[model samples]
Target: MAESHIDLGVVTAPSGVLVLGMASWIDHWPQLGGTLSERARASASIGGGHVHDWMCEMVAVRAAGDRPLTVRAGTAKSPLDGGPTIATLEIDLGIPWVRTAGNEPIILGDLPVDRCGMVLGDALALDSWTGDGHPSTDGLADVTYWGAHAEAAHRQFGGELIPGRGNQVRGWLDLPLDDAKSLGDALGDWTGDEQGRGVMVAVDEHNDFHSFNRASRTHPLLIGAIEVADCPVLGINWDSGDHSMRHRGERPFGQVYPVTLQPDRTGRTTMRWTIPPYAPGHDGPE
Candidate 1:
């Protein structure tokens, strides 16, 4: 009997032999069962592709699945800007359990199943999370990753990102047109996934915290209130009202660098930090 149709985003093409996450090229890619290829014609744009579409290339024929049906794929651009290369890939199906991601239809290739246990980041993503209404697999990263990519692409190519927040906390940071290269480089590693994953940054006057979470793109920090500085940085002790349960999302204890011409790498960067629900010290300082 034909398997129940699973919406693979756009159309329900028969559940292909593989399921993959679509993204720009990464220098470090995963390896597949069969030979990999670049320059795909109908490559699926599942996660995010606008950012690297020009700088990075595309791929297909990565039907490579593992005994456990694990797969990984990525691409990267060359200095010449000739095209992005499919790189940094690996898939080990040694896991005892083998099942599709919630039985939802995924790409034929592009699995995250790792034999030696999932990576720290992957483990966090794969873990079941329900602090709020967000499930671990509910595209939390997808929201963060593609959201930023789309914002960047729209600003660079189409124009300033839409759904603006008056002052534009999430739009293009007054970067020189030539700085597109630098911008892309700085944001290349940014991803949308923010599940069990967490990071702590020191807070300081010279720093300005920015929530890449597109949900808070219009956040007062990004939008800037009258009292707040133009670029918002997470301070050790910030205004409770400002930091209060933003959309019920967990706030990062660390701060991001200030939006200054020169980054103050001195004592004003990230200070102390921690990921919540997993308090560092049982009864340590709050």
Candidate 2:
């Protein structure tokens, strides 16, 4: 018997999906030089308007339903039909491939789906823009839907899954920081720390050939750690340090092209996910 290399399934995009994770979150951390509120007051500001206006504009732009609401899903099979590791999500938001399950199951989905489900049934696309937001580099759907779903669950299960309606219960409706941190903290098991120390290091792809696939852009990419306690997330950016996922912080590992996400405040939200481990020296997974 040989290990199964691929598992195929249908994960719904819900026809109104926008960005995944905090992919479109604009950084407003008060410490990284200053918060978005301060940037508006800074003399260096070129347009002579409060930076928040741009953020508001961006948020509005993303919410206008202008992008696709499709999510790509597939599975990772083990050698042979060894079943699956049934990885439970301690903190999984926009997983690339997953299914809902029943009874006692190892994998999230009950049985392996051989075909698409009701979620995949294409609804008449009402518009070109599904909602305001951007997609993750890895292309996951906005998982902030968790909040809406959580609310519905609370009405039924009442204190079974989570205590309350995510950030709303966490008091993060209109935060001052980038929406990414809030989206992550919405998991309720994590805390966010902003960093002013940034870096950009080019790694040798060694003819990986996949290098050409990277989306090219001109924003200063920063490399820093978002410590979800022991799980430190390393990220890259190419947008003007304005959004979270777009943070072009360069990484050294060409091998680990890791990116996970969750929905942010805007419609084009981020669906948070996990990052692969990086080699560390002194500062853990920096």
Off by over 4 Å in 2: 1-68, 77-286
Taking the tens digit of each residue's C-alpha lDDT, what string does model 2 give over 256-277?
Answer: 1222323323423232222222
- The lDDT of each candidate is 0.23, 0.23
Can you give the lDDT of residue 69 in candidate 2? Answer: 31
Query: TM-scores, in order shown?
Result: 0.18, 0.18
Residue-level lDDT tens digits of model 1 in 58-100: 2222221222222222333322232322223323222222234
Cα RMSD to native, each candidate? Answer: 23.0, 21.7
